[model samples]
Target: TILSSDAYQRSWKPNETNQQDERNFSRMVVRRLPAEVVADAITQATASNTRVTAMTSSPTDRTIGPDILAKNNKKLTSLNYTLSVFGKPDRTENCDCERSNAPTLLQAVFTRNDPSLISMINGSDRRAKGWIAEVQEWYSGKTKPTNQANGNKRLKQLNDQRKKLLAKAPKKPRNTRDAKATQRYQLTIKKHREAVQVLNRNISKLKGGRSNGNLVKRQITALETDKLINETFLRTVSRMPSANELNMARADINSNQDKIGGVKDLLWTLLNTKEFLVNH
Candidate 1:
């Protein structure tokens, strides 16, 4: 039977052949066995009265020579015969390996603005939601729900009362009694301001204590880095000229507008192309 490597080589034309062959010899079989199944088979073979030998390539070397195979056999007494062959094609393809139909987990995290990717990472399950909530709490450095709510309510009340008092206070003192009233009003404003300041300090402490402040700072830094990377990528892409524009420039077509929608058509074509669709 022709091996998968041979089949692949034969399927492609001479001109289409890659500079370096990329075939997976291990996956040549019609039915690929699981690692556990293969391990079990090896174990059973070893226990049998009949001698058995298995051939495999070295981690760094794709090809195995007869001398190397003999050297390996000297270290093991269980195998009766071993014939390791050289010239097996390496699996690595010469083409862009980064290309993919969808973004990976790390990619999704880096591009945090994508709602679809974020939703996928977060998941729809209750357990996932709980974990997400915990992460959000840590990132935000938020206080206890009840305390946050109460603090905000009190702050609002103080602000509202202060505003009301300020609005009702006399603009100018007309007499000694009026001046005394003005002084009292000023003292009341100062008292309210001090109370507001104290509440704000308490709220700050409650939200981000020393224990979580470092973690919050690190999260902010990571977010800022990602934002910078995203902005740089956007700027680079915006400055790049499309294939249609390049072609027009070559032809000395200086027109800024597309008369036959050539640019649009070229854009659509490029978008659908495998080169553009791939991540690379």
Candidate 2:
């Protein structure tokens, strides 16, 4: 029951509150990360000076964007990032593994963004300078990570809840009737705000909740407001792009513009990049 989405709803009480209790309720939990050790192991492995910094409620807590000067000629061929739930892939044969990985990964990655850089074997090791390298090495197996043993213990017990997807002889009958992809398919991602416009326009006809047109209009208004917020965020992010990014982007487009023409080329590039995409 504690894990249920509605669990806290039932537990709430309208009791008189003290200021101390209020402060206590608002305090954030501090959990140490196993990724710290992973970072250390990577520093040990790569022999490149890098460190991970932790997250704090400050703008200064950002670490290392991709190197702006990183060359197109030297573009990384095998860049990969892998982290599984608390119990990673192959940690355990249990039902709870997949259920637990996402939050764990978020926390681990968050903690990794902050670490104390104690020593510099190579060049000066600024605290966050080496983090990308450390993370890359850890995920790519410079050193063995810590969660595997603990996660494995619960695998069988948790996975017993569901049959393995890859089993050649599935333990139970398959449900094929609901397969949504009836053909070799194409997935079209229409612009998010653009795609939702139809729903917003006709929201009044679809009925739910406690009110009539008034309530539906309020919900649609909220969604549209959210769309505006997302646009604002993306615009702000785009404005902060590195100084030379536009020049580099233009260079890439010069080759293609002759084939597709300039107006469409500019439109496609801006629409497809981080500058225009607001992801949360």
Candidate 3:
């Protein structure tokens, strides 16, 4: 009988590996909120009718409302739930503790049309959250139609696709691949535009230039030398060259030195010229 069993085991063993063979799905034990949240959750569950009482001693001990309370004394005194994780890890024994954590309580208080969950942003945020939680729990417990599962199934698929795409995208910089990609783009892109010849070559294109847009016509600079006629009129007079009109006399001399009486007389007459109007 032992030999037959050994023969049977030998017959079942395979020498080669097959890639297409399906492997058993890995069983995952997800981290879950601990009992404290469950208890706080109970408070959240029966918030309306639930009244918490405590014993306080001033002179004598007396039964008082829960020491910390919100609007209706429904508060908690230190609500973090310490816990240990459990899972069947690879190369380890099953249900080994994975981590230690303190579970925070998620809470909500609501009236009709109020936020289902009270969040840090809004008191109503929690209330709405609680309502959503209740709805999810109903479906999770199989108490309601499994519609939530279907919804969650689609959500999980989309989330997985997004995660996969993100994972596949390049993560490391300063790589040859990145350098090549940048070089390729730089080579393909046009750095300077080609000169365009659009108008007819023979006919000068008419520019519909608005006078305002025409930038003051490259401002034709006039030669700063005085008008010949103005210089001649000044040289005709004999007057003393006043310091203010000294520049004017020089301008006259430069323009008509050749036609003047004599260089000395011209200088004398220029010095006496009345064009030098003296200040009172």
- What ranges in model 1 sit over 4 Å off? 1-140, 143-145, 171-280
lDDT of 3 by residue, 1-280 (tens): 8777754445333334432333521222223333333334323332221121211223221211222333333332222221111111232535535432332222111211112212211212211232223322332443333554454555555556545644554333355578877675554432211111222211122221112222231211122122222332343332233555556544554555342222222333322232321111
Model 1, 63-140: lDDT tens digits are 212234435543322111111011122326775443232324543232233332223223221112322233334446
Q: Per-residue error at 255 for model 2, in Å?
A: 14
**lDDT order of candidates, top first:** 1, 2, 3
TM-score preference between candidates 2 and 3, better one? 2
Residue 64, candidate 3: Cα error in Å is 62
Ranking by TM-score: 1, 2, 3
**Consecutive 10-residue window with the lowest summed lDDT within model 2:** 76-85
Which one is best on lDDT? 1
Candidate 3, residue 138: the lDDT equals 35
Tell me each candidate's TM-score: 0.20, 0.15, 0.14
